[model samples]
Target: MLKVCHMTSVHKRYDGRILKKECVSLVNAGYDVTLIVTDNKEDEIYRGVKITSIDFHPKNRLDRILNSKKRMLKKALNIDADVYHFHDPELIPVGIILHNKGKKVIYDSHEDFVQDIKEKVWIPNCIRIVLSFLFKYYEKISAKNFDMIITVTPHIVDKFLNYHRNVHMITNYPVVNFEDRKNNKRSDCNQICFTGLISPLWEHENIIKALNIMKKDDISYTLAGPSDEDYIKKLKDLDVNKRIKYMGVVDAIGVDIIQTHSVAGMAILKYSQTVGGKIGTLGNTKIFEYMYSQIPVICSDFVLWKEIIDKWKCGICVNPNDIDSISKAITFLKNNKLEAKTMGENGRRAVIQEYNWETQEKKLLALYAQIAGERVL
Candidate 1:
């Protein structure tokens, strides 16, 4: 087995994409995999992958970005794995150093960092633009040194094609098991669930407002994920009827239970120039997760998402910013139970046939095989 090490100065040790998807997949493919993350917890083996933490928990975002990369680099060098796959852009320098030392390097681009930087609310607008521009050039230059570039979406891949020839698109699709395929009993037919980042970007206030517009007392909303106190307060204020159930930071099983029990899953996001709008691609993991969980999705009417829902006959796509439009979609799904069930079935079929993680896993394994100069079976 070829030894591989994946490092991240940022992101949790068990981040869904990094550990649950990438590292775990590699381990299952017979690779000796080790994941390095910045945490205060002791290192251990889980799901057959070695997880080593650097013990430098960040006091703030800046500490992680500015200081953790150096510590990650030192630790990565000591491991001396054949391939070093890094997830964070802050660790780009670390990837370059490993490449210079004759080890294969892979840079996994989870998002359009250039576009993402523009939406950093903490950063001043003027500085954000300059940093985006500089980072664009920096990323372009650094990408050429890597053995492979793994990206999440098509638009992100287009951004890297100019700088590297070995770029590949491997999405973060949900890994559905045999049990997930069987229909689980819904805990509440009128319950709507939203999992993932619970921020303004997801348009949660509007979602709650839409629920109010429906005027259905039984139609409750469940939100699970991390959020700030201020944001939680803002949401609570809007949820005057106390219909919203907030589950702060749930595990994978918790997310599964919420989705399986809900009548519909929500991914209605707000778009803006700073956030570069929707990438109009299959990058949103929530939509796929909702589908795989056998629940219909109520999401933004972006062209790509609209097309998928239309073709799969899976869910309703609505204008996320319009309260009435969102309310109408929710109402239709709630009032029509049989149709909603069929839509959920269609969505899961689409995922099983085309959009599941198995397809992406093949691409990932092939990329690793190319790096190792071995043929993939």
Candidate 2:
């Protein structure tokens, strides 16, 4: 029997986008898999898969790095597996160690680490630059050593094409057959929704400002996600509390419900150096979720997003930084419900026909087969 070990340093649980679906697919394919992740305190079996959580504080910067490195390296050394699959960049050193031990390793690049570092405000610019450079250099070196490198985007794959021979793009798409009941219901109120980590990159301030400008009493904005106290305070100070509701961190099912009740979804990310690269990238699960829920989307007016919105007629594109533009987009969607509904339906159709988990999973399985030197199933 083939055995695979998967590692993640920062995930709250083993069951998230890439890891969860990948684990389920691999287990169904007759692979014996063991996932080593940061313990979220509640331990349980998920579809006959074994998950071993190592105690680590993901919030504590130094502890997260050190503990993840120690735990992953030790676990990789002890596990008798055919392949070692690593998800987090913090586990690169551990992957290197596992490679030296003659174990086949897979490095899954979830994002462009070099570009991502620029968004981190805690790290000094100089430090971020040095670390980004080091990360790229080591990533290239590590890719050569690993059996295969898996990435979420084709652009990311392009970055590695010159450096690595075995690079594949397995996008993060949502499972096709989720609860479809909510899609049929339209809320009486014109509610605009945004669901994601409440970070500076998300640009929630503009959304709040837009709400203040629109002054449309029938419409209210719901910002769902856990946020830092300072950021939350800033949101409160916007004087749109009556128009804005803060529904702290909703899980997958909860997010589905939220999206169902809203008129449209917002992916209004600021075009900072760090976020510019991520703005128009397709295959983000949220985009599919919004589409699947049959709600139009008001996204940042990036070239990439314009292509998608124009191609699918799924939603409107607006300047994320401009409060008036965002407010106008929301107002337009509200005033023209029929058009918005059509855009949403078109998006859902696109997702069902081309961009869902079923399509992406095949890429993943094929990539693994190629790495294992087996014929494509």
Best by lDDT: 1
Query: Where does model 1 exceed 4 Å of error?
Result: 179-181, 185-188, 216-218, 251-253, 272-278, 374-377
lDDT (0 to 1) per candidate: 0.86, 0.77
Model 2 lDDT tens row, 109-212: 87787788865778999998888888888777777778788887666777889898888888777777744543555736479898877777677788888888
Scanning candidate 1 in windows of ten residues, the lowest lDDT window is 272-281
Winning model by TM-score: 1
Q: For candidate 2, what is the TM-score?
A: 0.92
Clashes of 1: 0
> What lDDT score is found at residue 226 in candidate 1?
86
State every prediction's TM-score relative to the real structure.
0.94, 0.92
Candidate 2: deviation at residue 297, Å? Answer: 0.6
